[model samples]
Target chain A: EPEVTQTPSHQVTQMGQEVILRCVPISNHLYFYWYRQILGQKVEFLVSFYNNEISEKSEIFDDQFSVERPDGSNFTLKIRSTKLEDSAMYFCASGGRETQYFGPGTRLLVL
Target chain B: AQTVTQSQPEMSVQEAETVTLSCTYDTSENNYYLFWYKQPPSRQMILVIRQEAYKQQNATENRFSVNFQKAAKSFSLKISDSQLGDTAMYFCAATGANSKLTFGKGITLSVRP
Candidate 1:
């Protein structure tokens, strides 16, 4: 079966540095999304992208965060300046309809 | 806005037995979809099953099935002949026209041999 793939299974960086988590969603899917999960918290939606523009975003998706399709296959999330609270698992997903598929996720740790 | 809820924080079942995890979602839209996803120790999210809100019949896949009560706003997952390999965290989700999914906190299930 085709699967969503993410790069850099794990990443560690300084608190004030910048980091980008990348994902390649299923080829045929149209909508893309970004979600994050704190160690013991529920997965929270960050933003949704469709037609090359952001369709919707949550309050947590502030100016510090941005997402771009960059290329035909690569969808990335860039954090302007990371903080300790930014440490978490970031998952990229895609869906043609309602049932979205998720990637393995990138575990990011900010020191 | 939609919200998916999994009341049970955790559940356990004996091998070969049947277990059910509860889920409830709040949505006013008549057209939508519900889904169940499984995450094992590797933490990879796997799609377990899906249900279209308008479909009256519940959806089943092998040992996994859903009890979708559209009127009651409930969608639950039942795993039959449970195995130790079935141990994982299960999440319930709902999506509307925006095509964005709202997920529940999730229920951790342990199938003991």
Candidate 2:
């Protein structure tokens, strides 16, 4: 079965540095989303994208975070300045219907 | 805003036995979707089962089934003939008219041999 794919399975960056996590969602899906889970915490929604625009975002998705569909297949989440608290497992998901498919998350560590 | 709650933090079942994980959600929307996702040691989130709020008939996928109580706002997962491979972190989630999924704190399930 086709699945969402993400690059750089593990990312380590210095605090205050910029980091970009990349994902390639299922080709035919129209909606994409970003979610994060702090170690031992529930997964929290970050943002949702459709038609090359953000549909909704959580309070946690502040100015430091931005998502882009730079190409037909790539969805990227950029953090302007990484913070220690930003370290978590970031997941990318996509779905044409109500059932969204998740990718093997990218573990981000800002130290 | 919707919130998913998984009351159990951990559970264990002997091989071939049955295990049930509880989940509850707070949502006002009449139409929505509830899902159970399994995350093994690999940390890959895999969809185990799904139930549509509008459907009264519960959804089942092989050994995995759900008891969805729409009126009570509860959706629980039942795993039958549990195997070692079933050991994982299970998350219950819900999404309403908006597509953002609200996930419960996952429950760690260990299927013992």
RMSD of each: 0.9, 0.8
Please give, for residues B1-113, the per-residue lDDT of candidate 1 as tens digits.
89999989999999999999999999988899999999898888888999999899999999999999988999999999999999999999888987877889999999988
Real contacts recovered, all predictions: 0.65, 0.67
Question: Against the true structure, candidate 2 has what lDDT?
Answer: 0.95
| Steric clash pairs (candidate 1) | none
For candidate 2, write residues A1-111 as lDDT tens digits: 899999889999999999999999999999999999998888999999999999999999999999999989999999999999999999999993379999999999999
For A19-105, candidate 1 gives per-residue lDDT tens digits of: 999999999898999989888778888999999999999999998999999999999999989999999999999984568889999
User: Count of backbone clashes for each model?
Assistant: 0, 0
Interface DockQ of each model = 0.74, 0.73
